[model samples]
Target: MGKKYSDIKEKLQIVVDKKTTNDLAHLTHYFQNHKNGVSQCFRSSATEYLSELHEELNIAEEPNFQYYLPIKWDIPFPPTENPTFKFIDLFAGIGGIRLAYQNNGGKCVFTSEWDTYAKKTYEANFGEVPFGDITQISEKDIPDHDVLLGGFPCQPFSIAGVSKKNSLGRKHGFLDETQGTLFFDIARIIKHKKPKAFMLENVKNLVSHDKKKTFKVIISTLEKLGYNVHFKILNGKHYVPQNRERIIIVGFKKTVFKSKETFEFPDPQESNFVFKDILEPKVDDKYTLSDKLWNYLQEHARKHKAKGNGFGFGLTDLNGISRTISARYYKDGSEVLIPQKGKNPRRLTPRECARLQGFPDKFIIPVSNNQAYKQFGNSVVTPLIQAVAKNIVKELSKINESNQSKIAVHK
Candidate 1:
C-alpha cells in the first residue's frame, strides 16, 4: 500500500534537510493523499524515488503505518477531527491562511503554491507539500470543497486597456482577459467547483489599482460566476504588531445563499498589540546594520528630507507597532528596522517575523534568513484571517441549519 501523509512525514523528518529530498517527500505526500489518484506514471516515479531514498539513507526498521499527528499546539498544524467544512488553499504561502481556517475547524482538501523555498517551509509545517504553479493546474481535477481560500496575485491592471492593446496591435480578447493570469485559475476553479463560499486576500492597493477598474473586473467576474461578493480593507495591526494592510474579498454562491443574504467581514477589535510583544530578547550581531550601511541610510534620509521627501528607513519603537514588512525586508529591513540602544537599528529575526504574523512558536522556519523574510512578508496575518474565517464558517453553519430545518419540516 502507498504510504499516507502521516507516514511519509515521519520518513521525511530524517531526510528533509536536503532540498531535493524535501521536494520528493512533499510530492509523495501530496499524491498519496490526493482524492484523485495520481496517474500510474507519476505514482510509480514517486514511489520509486521514495524506495531509493530509503535505501540511500540506510533505514533498516519496519515502517510504522499507524501514524498519528500531534495536538493543535505542536510543530505541525494537523487537520481538525470531524471538520465543519472543507477549504482549498491557493497561493498558499507558508499556509498562514491555512492555519487561520484550520483553527476554525476547516480541513484543507487542496493546496497550491509556487515558491520553492516557501514550499520547503510549508511542507515542514503542514506535512503535505502544496501543488505548484496555479496556471499549470487543471481546474477539473480539483476536489470539491466548500470554501476556497486564496491570497491571489495582484499586479495592477493597466488603466488604458484599449489604448495599450491597440498600440501593441492586440485586440481585447482571451489574452487580454484573464488568460495567462493567476486570477484566471481562481475564476476557472470557482466556476467548476462552484464552492459554497470563498475568501480572497490581496494588497490593499488592489482596490485602487488601475483606478478601480481592476477591482470592478474582479467583482463582475465573481458575479458572473453566480456568487455574491463582499470586500473590505483590513489592517494586520489590529491583530499583530505590524501595520500591514490588505483587502479581503469574500463571496458566497447564489445557490447556497439567498440573494438577500449578506456577508460582512469581521469587525476589527481593539488590540494591545505592539512590537515589544514579538521582539526577540537576543539577536545575532549579523542582524544589526553595519556602520557603513547605517551611515549610508542616515545620509540618504538626510538628503530625502532636504529634498522634502519622506522616504527613509523606518525605526520601530518597542512599544509601538511596526511598518509593513515586505518581501524585500531581508535586503536591509528598511521598512521595519528595530532600534538598538547606542547602536545601529537591527533587522527582526525570522522568529520575530513569524510571531508578528500570528504564527505559533512551534511553527518551524526550516529555510534560510532570506527565504524566511520573504515567506513571512508575503504571508497573511493568521489571527485576522481566523476572525474572518470564523464569520464565514458561522454563516455557512446557519445555512446548513436552515436547510436541515426545512428538510425536517417537509418530513
Candidate 2:
C-alpha cells in the first residue's frame, strides 16, 4: 500500500531539509524489511516520515500508507530473498560482517552505527541507512532475530566500583562490571533479546587487556546469561594478504544447544596470498611519501633500531603478508607501506586497502580517501568472516532440522 521507494527517493533528493535524514533512514529500513516479516518494527516511524515528506514537498497526489511495494533495489547488496535466518548488526562499520553473514543466507533485520561517514558508505552499498547511536536506541525497538553480531569497543572495568559494590554485598555481575562501556550496551541487549546465537569481534589485544580481567569478565557475563561461550584469536592472513589478528567470541544459547554444543573455530588454512597480490598497477604519484617525510622516517627508524626498539615504520616485503592495517593508518600510512622501484615508499591506495581486507571491487566507496582508509582499516576480512559464518549457519540448520523431526515424530 505504500508508495514505491524509487518515487520517494527521487523526491528526497530535491528536499533541502537536514532533519529528514533520520526519517529517510526509517523509510529505507522499512522498505528493505517489508517482505522479511520484520517491517512492523519500522512501520510506524516510516509511515510518519513519508507523510511529513509529502506534506513538506506539497505534492498534490495522496499516497496510501499500508504495506510494502515491490521495490527494485539499485544498491549493490540488496536484502536477501526468503532468508533462512535473521540477525541484527550493531556497531556495523560499513557492513563487513553483515556481508559475510548475508552471503550465508542470513538477513539483517536491523542495523545501528554511530558514524556519519560510515553510514553514507553503508547506505550506498546496502541501500539502507543504519540507525545512528546504538546507545540511544532501546532493545525492545529492535526486531526479534536469530543471531546478533557486533564488533564493539571496550574499556577497562572500574576496580574501585567493583570493590565498593563487593563491600556493600551487592551483586556485581556483567551489568555492573561492563557498565559505562560500549560492551555494556551489547550485554544489555543480549540480556533482553535472548537471541539463539551471537558473534562479537575485537582486537586480539583484548585477550590480555587490563591483565586479562576484561576477557574473564566478558566470558563470565555470557555464562551467566545461559549461553555456552567459545572464543579464538583468528588471523586474517588465512584468507587475505594482511596480517590482521582479531579475537572472535561466539555464543550459543544453552536452551537451544542444551550445553552440548560442538562448535569449533575454523582452523587456519595455508595462505596463498602475498602483499603484492593486492597492489594497484597504476597508482597516482601522490601516494608516494614526500622526500622530507621519507628522510625523517628513515632517521626515526635508525634511532629506534639503535635502541633495540621495534617502534619503526614498516616497509612491507612484496612477497609476504603486510602488518595489520589500523584505523589510524590515514595519518601517515606508517604501519603498512609499499616499496617503490625508484622513489620513496608509497601508501596503499583505497582500492588496494579494500582488497587487503577481502572486500569486493563492486563495494562502493562514497567517502573521502581518508574516511575510506579508516573504514577499511576498521573492517574485518570478509572471506574469513564468511568462513566462520558458514559454520554458524550450518550448526543452526542442523539444530532446526533435529527439532522439526522431533515434533513430527510426536505428532
The candidate scoring highest on TM-score is 2
Task: Kindly report which residue pairs in candidate 2 clash with one another.
Answer: none
Residue 160, candidate 2: how far off, in angstroms? 25
Q: Tens digits of per-residue lDDT for model 1 on 290-310?
A: 999889888999999999988
What shift in Å separates residue 1 of candidate 1 from its native position after superposition? 17
Model 2, range 266-309, lDDT digits (tens) per residue? 99989889889889889999999999988988899999999998
What is the total number of backbone clashes in candidate 1? Answer: 0
Measured on C-alpha atoms, candidate 1 has an lDDT of 0.77
Q: For every candidate structure, what is the RMSD over all alpha carbons to the true structure, in angstroms?
A: 5.4, 5.4
